[model samples]
Target: MVREIMEEGLLTSRYQLPPNETKPTSNGADGDGLTDNLNMPSQPAASSLTLVLVFCTFVAVCGSFSYGCSLGYSSPAETGIMEDLDLSLAEYSVFGSIITIGGMVGAILSGKIADLIGRKRAMWFSDVLCTVGWLAIAFAKNALWLDIGRLLIGLGVSIFCYVVPVYIAEIAPKSYRGSFASSNQLMTSSGFAIMFFVGTFISWRTLTMIGAIPCVVQIIGLFFIPESPRWLAKCGREKEFEASLKRLRGENSDISEEAAEIRDYIATLEQQTEASFLELFQRRYANALIVGVGLMLLQQLGGNSAVVYYTSRIFKESGISGSLGLQVLAVLQVPAATIGLLLMDRSGRRPLLLVSASGLCFSYFLQGLAFCFKELPNLKALTPPLALSSTLIAATAFTIGLGGIPWIIMSEIFPINVKAQAGSLVTLVNWSTAWIMTYSFNFMMDWSLAGTFFFFSGISGLTVLFVAKLVPETKERTLEEIQASITHFM
Candidate 1:
């Protein structure tokens, strides 16, 4: 669930460009033209004007919207696509799940891609891939082309799922970081909701093309948004970093304290031996590593992907009309995302996760029972509304916490030096498990729909324990402070 929270102190500011503000002469330290005249103020920063921060977040979340469309597209598209291509259930299942396979590859490369090319460039590259993927799907006449297109979309979405949140986390102030970063999931919900509604009326190919429009918007937007200042500083481009940070903070806001804090932290990271992907498993890093990967694993295994991708099929297979349920879900997602956004910083991560996982357990149990009821005498009448209610509850619970908070915590807990390694591994595990479940979901449903849901319910129950024991509250803390508290128990 996502809501648009107006960030404090920025919405009503008298936004105006300075008369003397000149374009930076170069990409060096003066690129933003702030270095020579920038004052190193000793006082703590009061507040930042966030128009640019808001705009940059909007651009980044365009990728997130595309990601959501890719996930939500399969359900409404499934029936039409099968008829168009004469696809077998197995073939269509491959088409549905192929994105996760691509996601795995992209996850492996996402951190490195962000690190090498910079966050802004990585998003731009992913948008290009998604655009091509959508075009391929829009024109494909056969199953092979469909799978290839879906795979490309998956590859791109995986990178987006990793980079967008990380980029937002890096650029946002600690106070606003939770809500701003959570906006990534908010746009995702919007995309998924729109696709579910539109696909009901349009051809699958047309729907695929519609998905590409966001990609185009994001690609053009990349030129206007600044790269993550922390990333620029990581690369030792101090001038550009200051310039970028100053722009994000607003024309008049002082950038000195925050800039120095970032520099000091990055400097401290350079003193340690940076861990490779495998080295991330070391005991010293175990707390952060387990929390990151464990949450990702549980997030997928809880059946969000499989359920979302096949919602229509699930309803149809139960001999109920899914359109009403789908519509309700689309409507329900708004408040759900809103609730999550509103409570993100206020409720803190741990409580929300615990409550969400607990709700998921109950919702899935209802789903299993709803499926099970059809088999019993005189109970077939109850399946429709019961099934629909379970789905809405499950979705609301997932969105409220488990859906996006793992990502928020993932971005916060890792030090920049190992963020790439840790992020790649975590993202890969997420996609890998997603692949296993999504690819097998149809077959599993055939095996026993009730059984499949019960299994997912049990997994969610375990997730409750996992969060209660391991996941830490990361509210209201700087990234540096969060990482230290996570890994420095020694």
Candidate 2:
């Protein structure tokens, strides 16, 4: 009976209901100029693909841009901060890795915050946190101050990890949802690329101040956008729900069918007992939890974050111009992310995941081989170019799929009822593993560069297997349909 109700809810939400079914409306008095329709088909408004969506998505991803800034800040500032503060490698490492500690704590609470407040308010809260963090970093006079600032920024980033993609997913029309959701990654990569490019010309203090710009932009922009229609419906705010849905779909678009479908799904969800954290362990949610959390593990453990965070040092150690290498990374990151955004909906999720994981394996393998050749005196000259090429390849390949798809999948797979808990759990795993990998990366590099890349290469290979065997194709599916299908598969 439960499964049957779920399917009913999904089908209604994903498709137009029959003309005979009257939609839930405020007694023909909706001030948004919507009319009662007894003989109409439920379809997206002719203007469903509107400028408002584009603008709103852009605004929401400003938070993602801030997140990228926070991540990239330590890389460029590493030398300056260490020199100016007379810090050791250990101190610098602590400064660089402490963000993930904050990220872990924030991830654990991210969903609860989003659910407790609304999506827009959560973003507002995040922007405020990040702004303060950047300010703290900008004026820090000691190592203690720097570490404290980085931790606060990390907390903001943890919220970004969950909310940005989820916000984009909720607001976008199904026709363009994948591409729009891909924008979160694009903005994030742009953030990293921007810092990398701009840091070349600016002081570390100036760059930290620049980091606060996006937070302000996002905070102000949040006031102009509509809250998530889905979120409003879930909260039982019927009038606001209708208004938000109408605003997204357009004034004249027939939203009755879509509204009815959403209300039905919410109604079905309401019939079930409210779930607790422990309830997530049930077999019903296992596939989603596994896929969501598993991809996060694979993404972080594959060494992308560590590589991104420590690229300059890696290049210096390999006898390449660290500055030149960072420049090349800055140039390539956005184009790669843009390509992924364009391809997100056109190519299915599974294919992209497989290709991304495969490319990462090959790139890491090549880097490992380069480090191996470094030990051979005759082949020492080849190591620099090989390492440089491999870094570029890895950066490009990572952005192409793994960078964006995991979050997209996370936003899509879970049912509405368990979305908060599921998102938080997956996000927590992602950050915790990220923290462990990032914190340990330097030590691992010290142990053996060849071993480090080889280990990452192995993990990348495992990711390919995991995606092929377990991950589902979510292209073109409504959120309801995606969750229902995953449940059936499990």
Candidate 3:
């Protein structure tokens, strides 16, 4: 059956059985008629290399979080900075929007670059861009320079966010893929958590400069990790792929079965080389693209960035004063997001998204009520701190539900052939929406905090409905399997 499937090109090579596997061997090798020439060494116990990869991912993702934190915290601080620099709100918003604009371009282009140059090269490029962007921001004497700096930083973030998950997904074994991929989100939230505190202590300019430090660590760490085996196979470097797999799986490990699996998967991909970005819109690919794009849009509309970018503003509107409110909100995000990350792999994608979305809806609804009732005869005495605390709780709920999962789902939804492009498209939508919310949030706040919460709540409520109806569960599937499944939806 397996042979028939392979020969028909219906089964991916990764799923193909060994030529003569009539019986299973003690080593989990099938004793099919085919010779097992490649003996995988005893699986190396988890090593420093694994730690190194995790750390690299952490550092790479920190760039993303730093960008988010800097953007979020910096926006409010701009009120003060604008006086010093002689800038208008619109000018400041435009400068902030430059990051998303750069991200949109980067997200669209980085996939093609990663596909051509490989993931490692892409990371190195990202680090260089990050360093340069931060330096520009740190020294900027004018609004134009600041916007230019943000644009560069946005470009770096655009590439890093898309590339890191793809690299981690491709490199991790199937068993650990969920946990490993979720690590990107964990680190991202951690970055947000750290930035809140950092922003609290330092001037926004200093905070922006501090964000550059992680990229240095990322550039150095890249040297220690092996190139992705899947990328190697995609580049038609079979020997290199074998060596990479050996290093990742361990030199003394038994990877013959694994190698065979990869070879077959690559063969299947090679057979379909005509697939292109436009093909992603064709009937065969459209379903996956829709899911990918919809989830991206849903994530933004769910109001995660609105809260992240404006938590301080939201609190101040509710009556909380000083930078301390921002600090408290930031501190809350760490544990809330940490809890969400811990549950991500175990809870599966679809369920958590649904639950989180629903929670967000309820939280936002409450926030709206809190706003509406702020001047109620009986509730007029409620302290600003208490109202802000309620808003923080709502923001926490928003982060867990929609903040991290969209990135995870986007990373998992596409096949290797179009993964980068599709991922970039989705991320582009994400950042663009982020820019819209970030730009308009102050206006919304000016209208009413209750009104803003209500707006976000409506968005979150819609997302819950859409995800429940349209999104597929992608918890434990391999990349090939995810592609196959999404193909059906399309």
lDDT (tens digit, per residue) of candidate 3 on 1-490: 4533343345233443566653335443222212222222223233224554565456556555655554454644565557868888778777756777888888888888788899888988988887888889788888988888889888988888788878877777654666677666666666666667666666767777667877887888777777888889878898999987777765666777667756666677676654567756655567677777887887776666666666665666666664777667667876777777677667767777888777777777777777777768688546464567566766676567566677777777776777767877787888888778777777887788688878878887888888877787666455665665454442
Q: Write candidate 2's Cα lDDT for 1-490 as tens digits.
A: 5764564444334433475776565332121111222212333534277778889999999988998888777788888888888999889989899999999999988998998898999999888888888888899998898888889898988998898888888877666888999888899999999888888778899999889999999889999999998899999999999999888777877888878867876776777677788887776788888899999999999998898889888998888887788889899999999999898888767788888999999999999999999999999999999998998889988998999899999999887778889889999999899888998898899999999999999999999999988888776656765665675453
Candidate 1 yields a Cα-based lDDT of: 0.84
Of the pair 1 and 3, which is ahead by lDDT? Answer: 1
Off by over 4 Å in 2: 1-47
Candidate 3 achieves a global lDDT of 0.70
- Model 2 clash pairs? none
Write down the lDDT of every candidate, Cα atoms only.
0.84, 0.84, 0.70
TM-scores for candidates 1 onward, in order: 0.90, 0.92, 0.86
Kindly list the per-residue Cα lDDT of model 1 for residues 167-187, writing each as its tens digit.
999998877788898888788
**Which segments of model 3 are wrong by more than 4 Å?**
1-49, 52-56, 375-377, 383-386
How many backbone clashes are present in model 2? 0
lDDT of 1 at 188: 87
